[model samples]
Target: MKKQTHTVLKNVFGYENFRPLQEEIINRTIDGKDSFVLMPTGGGKSICFQIPALVFDGITIVVSPLISLMKDQVQALKSNGIKADFFNSSISPQEENEVINRAIKGDLQLLYLSPEKLISVRNTWLKQLNIKLVAIDEAHCVSMWGHDFRPEYTQLKVFRNSLPQVPFMALTATADKSARKDIEEQLGLTNSKLFISSFDRKNLSIEVRGQVQKKKKLQEIVNFIERRKNESGIIYCLSRKNTEEVTSYLKAEGHSVAFYHAGMNHEEREKTQTDFINDDTKIIVATIAFGMGIDKSNVRFVIHYNLPKNLEGYYQEIGRAGRDGLPSETLLYYNMRDFVLYSQFADGGANSVMQKEKLNRMLQFAEAKSCRRKILLSYFGEHLTDNCGNCDVCENPPKDFEGTILTQKALSGIARMGQTDGITMLINVLRGSNNADIHTKQYFNLKTYGIGKDVSFFDWRDYVIQMANQGLIEIMYAESSALKITPIGWEVLKGDKTIRLTVPTSPSDKKKQQKVAKITTGNDTNKDLFTELKKIRYAISKEEKVPAYIIFNDKSLKLMASQLPVTENEFLAISGVGMNKMEKYGEEFMQVIRKFKSVSKPRKTPTTDKTFILYKEGLSATEIAEKRSLSITTIFSHLSQLYSEGKEVELEKYVTKEIVDKVRIAFNKLDRKVELKPIYEKLNEEVSYGEIRLSVTLILKNE
Candidate 1:
């Protein structure tokens, strides 16, 4: 006669019906059945355990990995009106005692403990309380082969054996065949029932954007963020310094952004989390150190500024977005250097057996030809009805070619060239180059030398990358890009196997071959029109002391170009010009709008939702559409729905003409000024030079 969990779901959780698989898992857990929950990030994985714990007679123990995650879950649980707490070294002995007392006194339904904390001296006998359920989140960490492995996860098996009567569950977003098996074994849940939801997210478009230079790559990211303005999003950088660098860059660009990493003080990290959660900020540039339980739902996009260590890490990170069941996006910025670095870490060391396997799985995943989404689903033993056409590969499939002969020649050439020469030198030899090295080695006339004259250096390099991915050509980074043939490669070169490779397409060709982007402003030479409008918007922002986006968004600015509303009444008709802004500073901005309106003659409604999210959250619908794997029209449709439903406030609070002018002036002066630090620092204090710079950049780069 436990007061029905479904009732709690409807009343407190506010869900009339649990999404598929939720109730089954919850009921099983409440019945003390050990469970293996495989729900995706936003799939209500926590509900399965949180709900069951509500009905259980004892406190439910949640074993988490990171301090951030533990805190996030506890906070979310409290928000849901559930009694939940977490124990970590962050608290003093007195605080620990209070938490323990709460659990023992039946005042808490859920208690989150980091795996490291549980195995610590202070918490050794912690579980001696009336614990009924033990939920291990990010369960794949227990597997030595998972992306984020912890040695302490192995000790979870001991906890299960010690607390045998209590039910246990483990959850993760991305675990392939081997990692899943290892997690089950390591968690001592071999006999437990498994509950797996679909791994593929139809709305999440996956893609690897390759070969773009750093400046262009960053510009692409900025533009993407600008296109979708103020929705919440996370940008992942691979290194600690990079996290800080990106955070600084975005902040300088005029977005309210913050950084988080293992290198940061715990307090600073906590504050960053708070800023992001409270909506004081919308963008978080962080290292992998940030996720795993850091619950800030409604994140619209997750971009990997640097490639993730592995697909498991990539999957879990991207899973953070669209957790509220709305469309979200996932973009991974990949470079071959990232793979090489991760590979070097794999040759033994203290690397867990599972970490090694997961690393290999990620390698396999990167090389996968079938739909990226399909491979992910199939790995978890789920079947896909058809190819997921949401990934970059699916959207623009690299042209296919019969590389059987070329691959054979490359492998033979590498062996003959002594595994010491890098792909470049090897390729040169294959294509019959008589460079200094070849002339000095007296090897220019070899049979393979110059045989590949027909192949361009770029295409030949692409061939090498594909070969490295195929395991036919193993990369040797220790000695300057050397390509060594593997055992399988020997079999292939010996004509024992069929080797077909997909050539990596050149993104530049498509980009360059396209027509110049057409900007629909009212005047081309009167570029001064948009510039003048920006100056007015900047001026008002300075007086108001807010981000320029608060005054007039790109859409509104574009609308002003078309409508030219000189009066407040007419300006109000232009979208984004509501009552609040009209009262505050509408007269000045409306005048600027009127100046531009005389030319465009109101052809169509130019104000739009596309760049609105960008000005707010730095999301691009195309990127969003691509990241979420949804149709362009469908993403736009959801966006329109969201925009209409969201609260509409005044525009003047966020933007003005003075600040935009200042930012424009600052950029114009940077090259001329001897030192940049002083100018940028001064700008950060006013109209937030950091945020303005990023916006200005997006406008210039995309235009």
Candidate 2:
């Protein structure tokens, strides 16, 4: 069964092996057991069930939350030669009937439907099919505590109960302990095998910027985008108005940008999403309504124009980027106003208390002085013993010094004032301000009143916020936003535990201190070759009417550029190339490589001493093509002729003895025709045409 799973992984999914926990989940599902998967976005959750869907004899029903997600996954699966379909309102009645009929006839392996459709139409068509498994995606949405709850998800239990014999798998990317428990209960899974993969996306470099003025913040975002020009990214705004404003600003600055919000018509929103997915737009300025289950894998960055409502939403949003496992970035700009607005909105909801608590945790994350990843994972019940060195805080940690006296002054002021005043009042009193409020309370006479007078107002505010984030002090939002000292704060005030606070830099100073690192394509990757490969991929995407990533992700193209595979076997060894893709695209891509190599530079003579010198200097064929202004095949030709002439050239070094033997045997095995293309095809195109040509020269010369 494991060998069969590996075979499916390679031949169908184009992957060499399963990602962590994927094989186990697939095996469990194939063995007719229920599973609860809590993996992160882009964590290959789809494969966990999709593989089982293929292995199962009966059709697998997948309950997806969003129509876009279903469509994207179905298209991707179809491209990989899997028979899949989706039944949703987005399709016409006739089309839906066609899909239903196909599923009933056992023509489809996987059928994706929304929870609403599954419950509303279960009796109409779903009951007629032989359903082997029921997989619920976005299972977190079933819980009221989830960040993106849907009432329709609550009705899924009825649909599951009707099909009690089928194994059920509930999967979500951003569920916490509470949401996980609720999902299992709501889905009615009994004694299910639980799988919780790590939430860490190491490719994402998380950074948070203290809110600057509007113009400065926009400029900072623009600067960040400019450094990663022509890459796909998302800019999440807190409101539709901000989305429009940011979209206009970026458009005026000559960026390929668009805006999306729930206020837009369905067609308009759909167009925006399609354009972004099709690579027609480079940036999307959107409210939280967008990006629920977007599957675009090449998004290089996700920028939060304002702080999110909670850590779950923030994590899910950032997870959209770097899905291809390439290095990406996430930048968040946060201020107290965002928190206040979020709190006010939460007040109107039934789950106000939980929402406010989640909001505060998000604020703590944004204002954290230590490693941001630690605070984030800790919320999801994962502990990281070491700091993730990828985040901004980890890369440029603030200098900490003994601030025991500073914290004591703030804590003392709060205590003396009965802890009823907010951060502003405490800061004003500690700074010894002659404000009207302070004088009205006659707080100037207090000993702790002027204790922190040496600290500036902004510095005092920053320090207090830091204290709240560090849990030494708690902010009572329900009590008119007052600050109360915690047990830790009491210890600090009593000189029991020393407090070390990071030195606060003013907003202007911090903005000036911003540093942008240069983004490189990869150390060993050939940029020129990579660009050429991208051109081929884009051309194929255009011809096939699919997204470029559906053809091959950037990671696969990078490997191709690095490895310079010119044969079918070599191409298969590159990641993401399955037998289907190899058969469909192998010849075309190899043609491009052969053309690039053969005519990259026309040879004036058959052999050249300079070529050997450059080769001996360890310059690869591609590198020598650029340095000597010769085609890669021309260089190979010169080396091959030199070897034939019994010169100092080492034939085995240029082409491995193993490959040389295979190519010679392949060429000699074919009779009456010694052509490179025929020999290439006969050998399954595993050996490059260039290698075949070189081998033929040597064979004829030796004979």
Candidate 3:
């Protein structure tokens, strides 16, 4: 099994190492045992099934919910030179049939199909195939208690009944106690291997900040990205409107960006996806609809402009970064509004018991403070011996005050009330305060009215959430109110481990790095030119559904105004221009160029000037390279973006073939070898003294 697995790993996947449990999981599966793996998103979950699938005696049919995810997996597998294919709605029937045929003939190692399709008669393609393993991915989706519960997942149980002989591996990134039970039940894996990887992504530093107004928060994000410019990353927003707004916010700040959401047409979403994969877009401001199949590994950061629905979603979303085993930042902009809004999504369902449990768990995750990594890991039944010295808490170490007395009083107040009111009413009761309404409720409780005078209601509420986050308190939330204390909280009140608690600062008070949301101006003609170009770009942008600058970046705009390309051909010849973009967007820009030429103000060729392509103020050479597919040497050959008139320098010494042609253009007819001043003056024309020096160098260097 080792030799076969190693062969597949190297010859097919080309990976020299197996991520943690991957080799063991594969070896177990290849030995023909049922396995259930719970690996976090960045844990190389694919390899668990993929390795076993490749080396197994027959086909391994992987059941997944996301079509895009299947495509991503298939593409990655194919790139590794492994035989993998997907049959989904996106594929033609003929193609699907071919893939099915290949599976039946045992020519394929892994076949990914949607759960909805796998149960269909036509896709009973699996019926005739000798399937070695049935791997159910996102297995928690089968449980109503899971964050992304899909009803179709329940059918996996029925499918399992049909093929009682086949081994099943149920896999998911998330599941608490309830969800874990549901996965085992739904998949009918009563006696399967349960391999749960710790849900701790120590490499990912999770920092949640809020109460910095949305615009300022966006600017903060911009500042963060600016510091990390040129790195790959994602920024998630809650709504399509927010996605567009955030994308605009970032692009207005001059970031290379793309936006994605369900509101977009399939084509638009596909285009954004393609652009991201092809490296045309460095940052994607998107809703949760994106990242289903995103396999790009070098994503150095993932920022959430809005809170996600649950910890599972948050975990998966943030997990998209640092996949390449590098340090990446996960910035979550959290607020109460997000929590309340997302609760509505999990609001109504037939499975009330499971739904209530799942929602409360998510709430706990958001409000957590002490060893956030430990709590997240413990959810998957993995214990951490020492604090993960990576998450926000371990880095800063929150202030731990004794909240034992406070907890007992809060619990006593709830007992006296005889029923559950929300946190607000409960806090009010414990503080021993009386409004007209409070007096109506028996003029105060017997034992605990205002008993909590030592603690503010706000601070006490913070203690409740922190206790809940650490599993010390539990919320008996449902259609009916039942606020019950958990066993841990009871033990603390009964003189246990002293209730030593480290409370997190109010998310509202945490200092977010501030940013100037509004773009300031330099109060110059270039600034005016930049403004005008942005307007023109905005108009074109509405039609293209792209950010304004993707068409003509700020540096490109500066290049156009400073170079003042007077003709259509010259406009096309400007850097970052191709024939298609030039024809469509160039007329309005041409007017600006013509307008600038008429004023006859001496134009300062920007660092991106065709004759000065090697140096620039605003853009790096990589960005220029990405914008235009031309190589570094070719771009350097077209330079005039760097030369100045009064600066005295010898052209022969600094000059290479890279700039020789452009250098030859600036020499004057008299060729007197004066300073570079003559050349800068005649730059708009064909000849200047600087140009003659190149001809002199061609002879002087040779002699």
Candidate 4:
């Protein structure tokens, strides 16, 4: 099974080997066992079921959540020479019938469906077919505890019960402990084997910025995007108005941009999505309604104009970048106002308490003083022993100083003020303000009242927020927006514990602190060659009516430029090349490489002598020399000069074929593109430098 899987990996999918747990999951499913897989997006979850579908004797039914996802997956599978199709609302009646008939006849190896369609058709064509395995994608949606819950998914249990003998596999990218348990219970998975891959995308560099003024923030975003010109990206805003404004601003700046929201008509939204997927638009300023199941693999960045509502949503949004295993980036801009806005929205929901808790956790992540990756992974129930150096915090770490005195002052103020006020009031009390509330409460008479008066209001506020994020103080949202001191704060006040807080640096200062390393490639790499190769790829993609990455991703093109493969075997050795791709497009690409190699060879200028001109006119060199009143030896020199210049010369008239063959052998024995001295020495200096040069030039020209 392992050997067969490897064969399928190379020959069909063009991959070299299985990702971490793909083989184990495939083996379990082939043995007819229930499996629950929780791997991140772009983590090769499709291969787990696709491999077993090819290995099993019957067809596999994959339940997808979105029509677009189904279409993309089916197209990708067909491109890899797999027998796959999808049955969804987007397809015509005749098309659906053809797919159903194919499935009934066992002509298709894999079939895709939505939960609503699958459950509704349980007793219809689905029950009659020989179903081998049932694979549920986006399985977290079945759990009400999941972030993106769909009520129709709850009916899948009934559909699962009807096919009790077949193995069931549920897969998702993001799921917490509670959601995982709910998924298992809701899906009715009995004795299922669980496979949880790490949720770390090492290629994505995560960065968060506290919101500045609107103009400054917009300029910052523009600068970020300018660095990644002509690349596809997604900019997520919190509202339709923001999306429109951002899209307009970027468009005014000459960027290819579009906006998407629920307020638009169906046709408008479809057009926007289609344009983005086809790379006609470089950026999409969209709300949360967009990008649930988007399958575009070359997105280079994902920027949040505002903070997301939860860790799950943020993680899933950032997962859209770098899907092609290339370097990508994610930027999140957040502030206290966004948190307040989210809190207000949560207050009106049914699960207000849970929503607020989730929002608070997200806030803590944004204000974290340590590695952002650590905080993000820990939220998904994975612990990291070391800091991931890819994120902003790890790259430009905040300055740490002894903040015990500051922490004690803030804690004493909160404690002495009766813990019945929010951050503003607490900061006011610390600064000894003369406001009406302070006078009414007589809060200025406390021992800790004016202790922090030397610090400005904004500075005190930032320090207090930092303390809250570090768990020295807790924000009691349900208790009239009061602040409560924790045990750690008490310890700090009593001088029993020391506290260290990170000083907030300005954005410009932080930017100056970052030092990027340079990347070097092989000597064969040429920028002009890479551009020419890209032109070929773009032409092929246009002809096929597919995105450029579908033919060959940017990483594959870079490898092609660096290695410069010129033969079938060498082209196949490139990373993304498989048997199918090599057979389909190998010869065309190799032709380009061969032509480039021939044109790039160093050549001397053509000779300009009248003797050479006469020789080229079909006159003998001796005759030309005699006609021109010059010596025969001089004409021979002129002939050697013409041959060395890579021009056509009658080499047989001067040197015999045997001598030319010996010189060619000597040149071949030495390294390619070497000077003539090495070949002369290797030939024992029997041939003169001029004759040797002429013979080498003729041999190279023939090659």
Candidate 5:
């Protein structure tokens, strides 16, 4: 079973190994057992069932919620030489009948349908076909506790009961523990194995910029887009009007961009999505209606122009970037206004309490002073032991001070106001604002009311937020977002316990925060070569009538440019390269590589070139190090550098796969830096530094 599954994975899907728990999940499903998989987006959830579908004699039916997702998945599958098709409203009745006939005739290996389509066809045409496995994509939609619940998914319980003989696998990218339990209950899975993959996407750097003026914020966004320069990105807005406004602003700023929202007609939305997916359009400013189940792997960044309603949606949306496992960026611009606006929207919902709580969590994440990734993962019930150095907080941590007096004053104001008002009112009271409400309530007469008049309203707001974050106060969302003092607040108010808070960063102070870090695509791949490969991919996409990623993602193209794979066997060794792809697209890509190599300059360092020569002359890196009287660490560094420069240095000769894996694991735990000292320390000094350097290079190459 393992060999067959591996063969399918390699020869068909072009992957060398199963991601964590993917093999286990596949084996469980093949054994006629139910399983639930909670993996992050771009975490290879589709492969879990795609492999089983290929291995099984009967067709595997996939229940997806989006027609775009089905079409994309089916196209990708067909490109890999897998027999797959979809039945959805997007297709004509004749086309649907053809798909149905193919399934009934045992010609199709996998079939995808929407939940509504599945429910409609289950008793009639679905039962006539042989079914081996039923995989539900976006399984979170089935649970009311989930962020994006759909009523059609609740009817799937009937389908589950009827297909008792078939194994069931429910998959989602973002589900908390409550949602997980709800899904299992809804699916009627008995003793099912549940797998929750790590929710951390280390390649994406998270940043939240707040309290900037609207004009400055728009300029900052323009500056951000300018820095990326031709990379694809998504700027998520909260409303259709915002999408249009952002789209027009970017267009006026001379960018190739478009807008997408629920308000757009079907054809308009489809064309916009297609243009973005095909790379004809570079930036997409859209509402949350975009990017669900989008398989575009080359998106380099994601920006949130407004605050998202919940952490799950925000995480899932940001997960859209860097899907190819290359370094990417996520920038969020939010303020107190976004919070209040979302709070008002959440106020009248059926799940108002839950909605407000989730919104509060989202606001906390935006206003957080610690690692943003840690907060996001913890919300999804995945805890990280160490601070992720990939967020703005980790990079530009705010300064802390003894803020006991400040916290006490703020808490005192809230308490004196009877804790009846929210953050705005509390700030007003603290800053001694002469607003009509304050004058009507005669709040200027109170002791706490004019005591903090020296502090600016913005500064007061920041201090209050810092206090809330520190648990010195709480916001009662159910009661019009009233401010309430916590047990810790009393201690701070009475000076029994001292509290430290981050100094409020004014707009001018934030301007001095370090400039955005340089975005790393990959290790020194030839940019010219990458560009040429994209051109070829775009041409092929136009010819083949599929998204460019279906031909080859940017990661695969980067590897091609780095490795300069000129032979069929060498091409197959590239990540995302399989026998089918190698046979189909090998000659064209290899020709490009060959031409570039022939014309490209060597651009070599003398010392590294000398080491490369000796290593190429059948000398191991260690042997060369000993022969040249150089340190092994220096020799390994030379080889890694040469590898990054497109030279084939057999890394396996210097380090065993197990050693490389251990070093890679340790390297991931730390911030992914080129320095080996941190990784060496993280591995407890068990692995040699030379091996760590070589292993890090290999990991980046494969990524």
Candidate 6:
């Protein structure tokens, strides 16, 4: 059975191997048992049941909530030579009957229907078919604890009783533990095995920016979009009006963007979605109503223009990007105003308490000082022990410095001034201001006067706030908003305790923080080849009337460009290339690859070679990173790649022997060809990613 599943996986799905837990779930379901899958979006949840459907003799019934989702999956499945179709309102009655007829004749392997449609057809239409497996996509909708609760999904339990012999599999991308339990109970999967894959989408870099003025936020968005021109992205807004406003702003800035919202008519919404899927539209500024059913895998970025109401919704929304397993970016702009508005929106509902609680967690994530990915994964009950270096916090941590002297000066000024003034008055006293209030109070008589005279007034305010936050002082709001010293504050003043304060980010620092590392090909030739392949994919998509990704995702095209596959045999070896696709679109793509490879010359001085030269000059990785303005992780990754190419790199100097042994043990236990993340986790995350890379390179070098 496992071999059959693997065969089907390779021949039908074009995947060389199963993702973690996918094979186990598929085998359990094939053995006529129930399984509940809690995998992240783009984590191969479809293949769990789709492969079993092909392996089973009878057809599989997949209950999906959105027509767009059903259509997307069915289109991709049919393109792979699998007989699949969807039954929804989007299809005519004749087409629905035709699908039913095909299913009855055993000509179709998978049939998709929405929850409402399935319930409606349960008595009249479902009894006529031989259903082998029942798979529910977006199974979270069945649970009230889920972010997207649909009452119709509650009626889907009827399938368990009606098709008692058929195995059931429920899947969702963003369900917390509560939602997971509720889904099982609601779906009557009492004896089902639950599988939760890692929620970390390593390809998506998470970031959050807050406290910017409205104009500046818009300008930042414009700047972000400008850098990734022609790449697809989405900007989620809090309201329909905000969506239209952002869309207009982007358009005025000369972008191929559009707005999508519930308020837009169906035709308008479909056209916008179609344009986006076809790559004719580069950006979609929309409210939360836009991305649930979208299966477009090439979304390069996702921007939350306003704060999301809850972490579940936010996670699923950001999951829309990098679905093709390539690097993507997710930026969230939030403020207190968005929190207040969402709080009000969550009020008076039955789940109001839960909603507000989730919103609070979301806000905490936006305001978090730790790794943003850790906070997000922990919210979904996936604890990441190591800080993912891909997030904004890990990349650009706070500049902490020993601020004992700074705190002592402010505390001494506050005590000498009788501890009776507000923050502004304290600042004035410390900076030796000659203001009327300070002079009238004769605060200049304080011995600590002019102690902080060299410090700027703005810097003093920041220091005072930090002191209050650190419990070194208190802001007595009830006592006429006076600044009072706490016991901890006295200890600092008396030199008993030391404290560290982070340097506040200035406007220029904020601009520097907005820069993201671009995902690039190895050289100019690979990039040109990739561009040509995308054109071919888009042309085929136009001719076939499907999303370009349904033909071949950007990941596949990238691999084609990098490997320069110009023959059918070589093209078939590419990922996402089944024999069906190889037979259909292979020649055209091969033609492009052949022409590009024929004309392209060998490159000189690749990016990694530059790093090698710098390494040879005796500069440390940190020093090189500082000089190049690149992250230290990137520098290490470059060196690791150079080592992989058999270059003379002393990669051992970057990692300790203890780390090398741990990584070696982890790699030997797991699939060695897998990415670095699984190995990082297998080592219990005690090793940093850079350390893991260096250790793995050393292990392979020794082997």
- TM-scores, all candidates, are 0.63, 0.79, 0.59, 0.77, 0.80, 0.75
User: Model 6, stretches more than 4 Å misplaced?
Assistant: 401-500, 506-519, 601-703
Model 6 — which ten-residue stretch has the worst lDDT? 507-516
Model 3 ranges off by over 4 Å: 122-124, 344-357, 400-703
Error of 2 at 297 (Å): 0.5
Ten consecutive residues with minimal summed lDDT in candidate 4?
512-521
lDDT per residue (tens digit) for residues 1-703 in model 5: 8877876776567677889999999999889999999999999899999999988889999999989989999999999878899998899889988998898999999999999999998899898988999999999999999989999999999999997888999999988888999999998887889998988898888888776667888888898888778989999998899899988989999999999999989999999999999999999999998999589998989999999999999999999998999888898988877887888887778889999889888988889888888898888777998998877787777899888888888888888889898887877877778899998988889898878888877677778878888888887765877889999888889889998888764432233223333344443447788999999999999999999999999889988898787754457667898656776788899999889988876434456778888988998767987887655656777888888888977777778999988987787778676555457558865676568878988999988
TM-score, candidate number 5: 0.80
Tens digits of per-residue lDDT for model 3 on 347-373?
A: 765665555455566656655666777
TM-score preference between candidates 3 and 6, better one: 6
Q: What is the lDDT of residue 303 in candidate 6?
A: 97
State model 3's lDDT.
Answer: 0.67
| lDDT (Cα) of model 1 | 0.68
**Number of backbone-clashing residue pairs for each candidate, in the order shown:** 60, 3, 18, 0, 0, 0
List all candidate RMSDs to the true structure.
16.9, 8.5, 15.3, 14.4, 11.9, 15.2
lDDT of 2 by residue, 1-703 (tens): 7866775777677787688999999988888889999999899999999888877888999999899989888988988778999998899989988998899899999999988789888888777899999999999899987888899999888887887778899999888778888888888897898999999998888888774569989988887777678999999999999999999999988999999999999999999998898888989999988988589889989999999988999999999998999888888998777887788788898888898888878887888878999999998889999999877777777888988888888888999999898888888888788889888998998888877888887688788888987789887766878888899989999999998889874333233224323344544326777788888888888888777888888888888766666755557667888656776787787776666667554444323667777888988878876897644545666777667767766655567767777877777678725455557657864675457757777677767
Best by lDDT: 5
